[model samples]
Target: MISGVASESSSQLLPWQQPIWQDLVRRQQQSGLPHALMFTGIAGIGKHELSLRVAHWLLCQNSSGQADGLTESCGHCHSCQLWQAGSHPDFMVCQPEDNSRQIRIDSIRKVNEFLAQTPQISRCQVVVIRPVEVMNTNAANALLKTLEEPAGESFLLLEAERFGSVLPTIRSRCQRIQLLAPSAEQAQQWLQASGVSPDQASQALRYNPQAPLQAQLWLEHNLGEQQQQWLDLFGQWTQGRAPLDKVVAAYTKMELDDVIHWYAGVLADALKLTLSVAEDQLLHGGWLAQLLNACGDGATLNKTKLITLQRNVQEIQGGLLSGAAHHNKQLLNESLLLQWRALLQ
Candidate 1:
């Protein structure tokens, strides 16, 4: 429970947390409304919150479905009360119920049942599904069937990480709204206020609020195990004896998403070693120095090689989007390190 706030239900959100509230309000007020909406963004970015607010708007007795542009739910209204209490029969929120880390068919089946009914307050019934792409084969099919036919005035809201992973059919049926990361300065101030130390604040803020700023702060402030994830790869990539297991295990910890950070630290150090940059204040100066000794670059790293590192980072984002792993992660990392090795050669 954040201070001075209600239970912080997924629908009520900080203004900066989501930038599209007014746009949503405008549509609600203007009476242009969709039967289904898809919200996509990083975790903790108020996807759930925004969806709830939309549900409230739909259920609001006074709402004409115009985008009021007020960017808020009427807290005094009956719809808002039911939503704030999470007791609205016409309102449903679904997420993975299984401890198995997947949103299974049974949960979505329940959503189908909920949508089949009429709204208690108004003609509109709102259903929200978080991490919606987790729907397995059968679940996705069940949802596809609903999308094909008319289902009264129900509005289905889904929040997913990889929007493309959702069935193309489902994507076609719903309008999508994307939320992005906060600015660096904004993120930095948020992290610091949350108690992150000055040394760790800068790196921690590089990722947006929804990207686990607090977790990154914890990792950076403490002498935690960042090396274990990549040390084996670093060792074997140099000797060319690196087993697939070493690379895979390292990647499982670091993941393709995190590759750029490692490169950012290492490459920044190489710049200093080459005298291209002053030594006083590298972000990861200590870690940078250590990687340089291991990778062996005297001064400015191979500019040609740094380009390859940049490319590898891009590929990681691509791999996540394409749902491809292993080969892509391995090829990207090993390929970049091989470029680094060439400088030593």
Candidate 2:
């Protein structure tokens, strides 16, 4: 079965989303809300959550608007109660099934069926299809039909990380809303507000630049310590103070994609240091000095080696994202580490 039936409601907008939210509300108030909207942004910037907020607002039965000129759903209302309970008749969400990345034709077909129905509870029916770029050609084409002839009071909210990745035909049919990540300062503030320690917040941002929510999740998972441990081991291995096999074994126990990403960050920092870039401009600026001291020779890595390693990490990251690393994760990790050792020579 196609996954993603219900959306968790968001009561507040992320700080960075205020302007976009206001613009959307103005359009909504002016009766200019489009039948379809495409929200595009990098991951963890709250595109999906923003869509849910808008959906909740659209589904809200509250007649009395907020005094702040922003309209939010009153949680006590019957429509909202139904929405929160995940049994709202007028709402549906389409996404990839479990263990899959691509949104198949079956899901889009279901969306078509859902859109064919009239609103049962509210003034409109809403469907949210996230990461729309993952839809296969057949699925995209199927969705295009619904976009072309949208049913009465039916709205489609589509999300994708890369706007250019979506089909042109589909792009033309929807109003595009692009989301930008918050500044580092803003992200760090938000993370601190969310109860993460200042140091942890900074480290998380280093691991996940411009994406505060992702950084927040990283902190929640207590992966910051894991990252530091991995970096220390990596430094030791690169310095020939630790065995490659043991380092690889330790990494295999962690999330491979994150491990690769952190490794890429280390290489990037090394390149920056080699080029005499300011420490403040570095991603791992706080821990970099200590890390370099630990890395020894790895810290003074030439730009050529660093760039090559960066490219290798990028390829492995792409493989992970494309689901190509599922079965060959061990091989991929070993190959990357072996190449790291080779570049040290």
Candidate 3:
């Protein structure tokens, strides 16, 4: 039952999305827009925002009749005003309930009912469902009905982090557009423009890779110093200079999923170093050199061991994301730290 109208901020497009935006605008202008569209990409690459922007354009009162060749919404129109206030009658957003992973059948049923009605103000009705991969089978099946027999002038905009994870039936019915992460240079420029310092921006990109929005979030949270401290502790633990409990204590303060992601990045860098990967190619290259110095050298960092540790971390991450329950968090962190310590031993 989580349903709401998109805010004005959601209508803004990211710079990297310009090409896709232009193409969609052309399709929309030519009356070639699909009844159902699914945007697929890694999280934080602006899939949801792009979808909402299209939704906003579709619902704008001035969009259809504009002779000025404008493809964007007029923000001051009555429809845009309603949308900005989160009370738009013709638009809806469906997502997982708070603190829940799955969007149940109940929500999709509401979506069906919402789309069943005529457009109250705008010329069309639009519904946005994000991370559609999390919809349970019943929920997805319920959505399939709308996709198969779409109501007049109604558009369903869906987003998923992984296209392969979406139901095959859902995929076949929707026009799929895959968004790509921005290049490192483009990401750093965006972060810097957003007020992150150059060095901080670069470091965040290293930690987050091609995901600029996520890198910006990393900077906003001021996690760079803490991340470095965690890396140093990891280096000490691997060298047997710091106790395993000490390292685990520091890491447990963060969410287990985040801790594991950081650990995986470290392992990835170590594996790269073991294979003589150039420094520029490493995700956490800044810390790897110091880590190798602390531990001995590349000779001590075994490639096979790093791969095995990465697999273990990935398994834990997958379980955590899948909502697996009954995990003993502290013990799990301890076990992972012990595995890291063994790399040096």
Winner by TM-score: 3
Order of the predicted models by lDDT, top scorer first: 3, 2, 1
* Candidate 3 Cα misplacement greater than 4 A, ranges: 65-70, 296-299, 321-326
Ranking by TM-score: 3, 2, 1
In terms of lDDT, the poorest run of 10 residues in model 1 is: 1-10
Q: What is the clash count for each candidate, in the order shown? A: 17, 0, 0
lDDT of 1 at 220: 58
lDDT of 3 by residue, 1-345 (tens): 466656898789999999999999887776568899999888767998898899889889988833454688889899999999989999889988867767888989999999999999999999999778878889989988899999888999999886887889999999999899988788888889888789888788877778888887787787778887887887787777888778878887887777877877888787777778898898765567776675564436556776898898888776655433346778988988877666763
**Of the candidates numbered 2 and 3, which has the greater TM-score value?**
3
- lDDT of candidate 1? 0.63
lDDT of 3 at 38: 93
In order, candidate lDDTs are 0.63, 0.79, 0.82
- The candidate 3 region of ten consecutive residues with least summed lDDT is 318-327
Q: Which consecutive 10 residues in model 2 have the weakest lDDT in total?
A: 63-72
TM-score of each: 0.63, 0.87, 0.90
Best by lDDT: 3
Which structure is stronger by lDDT: 1 or 3? 3
Query: Candidate 1 has what TM-score?
Result: 0.63
C-alpha RMSD in Å of predicted model 3 compared with the true structure: 2.6
